[model samples]
Target chain A: MITFKNVTKEYPPKTHALAGVSFRIEAGEFVSITGQSGSGKSTVAKMIFAEEMPTSGHIHIGDWDISNIRHSDIPVLRRQIGVVFQDFKLLPKKTAFENVAFALEVAGESTKRIREVVPHVLKIVGLGEKGGRYPRQLSGGEQQRVSIARALVHRPKIIVADEPTGNLDAITAREIIELFTRINDFGTTVVLVTHDRDIVNGLHRRVITLRDGKVSSDAEKGKYLLS
Target chain B: MRSFFRIIRFALQSMMRNFWLSFVTVSVFVLTLVTVNAVIVLNVLANASVKSVEGRVQVTVYFTSDASESTVKNVQSYLLGLSQVKDVSYVTADEALAQFKENHQNDPVILASLDEVDGNPLGQALKIRAYNAGDFPFVLQALETPEYKPFIKDKNYNNYESALRVLSDFSEKVRLGFLILALFFGFIATLIVFNTIRVAIYVHRDEIGIMKLVGANDWFVRGPFLFESICYAFIATVVMGVLLSAFLTFANPAIVAFFQGVDVDLVSYYLTNALPMFGAQFGILALLGLGTTTFAMRRYLRV
Candidate 1:
């Protein structure tokens, strides 16, 4: 579960990235946050990972209030909540399996455990056969799948993806979204942030749209409401 | 312990992946160390040369020919008793006359003048050697006592004293020049290492970000880079050690032959001090590399 209660984040000279935003999603939910370029949806995703702190109010992921989390605790929070970025963010020098295993390695997992779990997760993302391929050798969708596999390696409780399909073609994008759906079906909470209208309309899931740093709409089955 | 091995593995992998960069960094480290060792070699040779020249300089005290043999012997005993005086050899008047004739044998006018003088006119002399050339003045001044002054003919220490001063000054200047050269090389080495790390970090900027985003702690991200810098230091030191041994093997015989009588044995000197000398060089280089790596990481590696 994730909750943001009246959180406000501001930049220098009164540029408000988020203005008094409040939202909550229960466990095992698949949620899409939709917005224009500067609607603060990305900021919301960043806050979930504690990459950005709120200027006022608070953010709580389960029982952890990360509004004033210590610097040393950020990694712990990040490990609990996996983050996927628009760029895929795979280490270019590493193969798909190594990239996935990197997550567990940082967590000090055993080699035997990594060898077992990395292949399993890569298979879940449909990269089992391509585990040895480096990021440069993979297609756009394949790279995104690798990124997802990495996020899933820790079996994180929540997955926050910010524009993960932004660089993919329509077919590949849909495949990635379906992969997220499959992951959610396994009881992992998925929060997808995007501006693509068709992907949102097709999902027909809970949607929270932001406008001018404020939430404009929230519906259990929402469509892309902005032009 | 597992993490430690993983860090080392990652460092080796990174180095191999960036082979040319690693090569350049280590090469620069070796160059810096070569300059440092050159200064050391120059210092050793300079000290040896100075000591050789100092050994040849001694004060000769000439006593009048009529001065008794007992009196000259007493003077030698007195000079030898001082801690600063290393040795004093008494030359009889007859031996002095013979040495004078031998030295002037090629000069007909000097030999004729020496033959015309009353039989064996040269005086008994005492050659006084001191532990340090600077102590000659004190030794010479000691002879001015009234008991010995009446029989004394001449003392020749002032000439050698001026020559020693000039030699000392030149040696000091040479040492100072090499020091400046070494420092300049060290500065260039620091800059190159700093830039090398910065460039390597830039090349891996995306990887570093990915690692951090994937939940790597600060040490986990920094470990490989710090280890890589240490590897460069270790490799460069080993390479330098091999190169110096080869150089000494080829150059020692020629050096000994050139300074024939000067007792300059570079091979032996290096052999005796190799462990401490190389150990100190490695320590300094490792410290420098670590410092530069930390600074570069702080500037460019946000994680």
Candidate 2:
């Protein structure tokens, strides 16, 4: 579960990215955070990961208060919440499998565990046959799937997907969204932050819309709305 | 145990993937360590030679020709009593003439000249050896004390004193000069190694960024590079040590013959007493390998 209590993030010179934004994401729920560029959707994701601390508010994931967490402990927080970026940040030199295994390796996972878990995640992303291929060898959609596989290695309780299909074609983006839906069906919570109206309308999940750094709408089985 | 192996496997894979960058990094480490090792060996050899020469230099106090045998013996006994004097051997004029004849036996002109010195013209002298080279000058100074002043005549004292002073001063200067030269090379080596590592890091900036983004721990990311550097330095050290030892062991005789009139055989003398050189080289290699890598890593890899 994730909770934002009056979270305010302000850059210097008084530019408020998130002004007293408050919300809660319950466990095992698939929810979309819809906002245009610079509307502070990514800021919300960053705050959840503690990449940027809230300027004047309490942010909680489960029972942990991450607003005051030290930089060294950020990785521990990251392990619990899988994050997918707009750009699939895979190590180019590594095979798709190596890119996924790297996530487990950094966490000091046993080779046996990495060997077992990596293929399972790749299979879920439908790249089980392409594990040996490097990132450059894979399609853009396939690369994003590899990143998703990497994020799933820890069996994280929540996935924070920021524009998961931003760079993909409409069909490929639909496939990625369908993959998210499948992952959520397996009892993991998914928080998708995107401006893709068609995907949001297609999902028919709970949606939270942001307008000018504030939550504009919170609807169950919501349609995409620009505020 | 398994986790550690995993880390190692990951590191090895990463290193292999970034081959050229790793090679550049390790080569820098090797070059720095080699320079450091050479300087250290040279410093050790210089110090050891100076100490050997200093230890061997004996002050020969010649007595007056008119001095009685009993009086010369008293003077020798007095010189032996000094605490600074390690050993004193009294060589009579007859013994000196015999020693001179034996030394010049190969040279007929010198042998004839030595035979012409009719009735043992050399005086009875006391040859004094000191414990340490540094103690030689102190022993010379102690000879001029009131207690031994009467025994030390001006007959041969001035020349011996100046010679001793020159040798001691030269040894001190050589020691200081080697130290300065070693430090200069050390600085240059460090800078070269630092720049090479920096350049390598610059070349692999993307890989490093990828590693960081993927959540590699600082040690996990740094360990392979550090190990590579240490391996390079260690191999270079072994190679340099073997080459130096072989050169000293095999080339010594030829070098001694070349400098036939010199007191020290540049090679054999160093090889014979080379424990310090080994210690110095090993120490320099470790310092260079560890110090330069640690420094370069801190500056470049902030994490």
All candidates: CA RMSD (Å): 2.7, 5.2
Give me the runs in candidate 2 sitting further than 4 Å from their true place: B1-164, B188-243, B246-303
Instruction: Give chain A TM for each model in order.
Output: 0.99, 0.98
Report the error of model 1 at residue A142, Å. 1.7
Instruction: State each candidate's clash count.
Output: 0, 0
- Top candidate (DockQ): 1
User: Relative to the unseen true structure, what is the C-alpha lDDT of residue A109 in candidate 2, on a scale of 0 to 100?
Assistant: 85
Q: What is the per-residue lDDT of model 2 for residues B191-299, given as tens digits with 9 covering 90 to 100?
A: 7656655665675576565555555566766665565455545555566666667766776677556534445465554567566765566566557756887888898
Assess candidate 1 and give its lDDT: 0.89
Clashing pairs in 1: none
Q: How would the docking of model 1 be graded?
A: medium
Best by TM-score: 1
Q: What proportion of the true contacts does each candidate reproduce?
A: 0.69, 0.36
Q: Can you write out model 1's per-residue Cα lDDT over B1-303, one digit (the tens) per residue?
A: 878888898889888888998888899889888878887887788788777878888888999977999999999899889999999998988788888788788999988887787777788999989999888889989999999999999996635666767877887787788778767767777887788788878887887777778788898889998898889889998999999989989998998888768888888898899899988988888899899999999998886
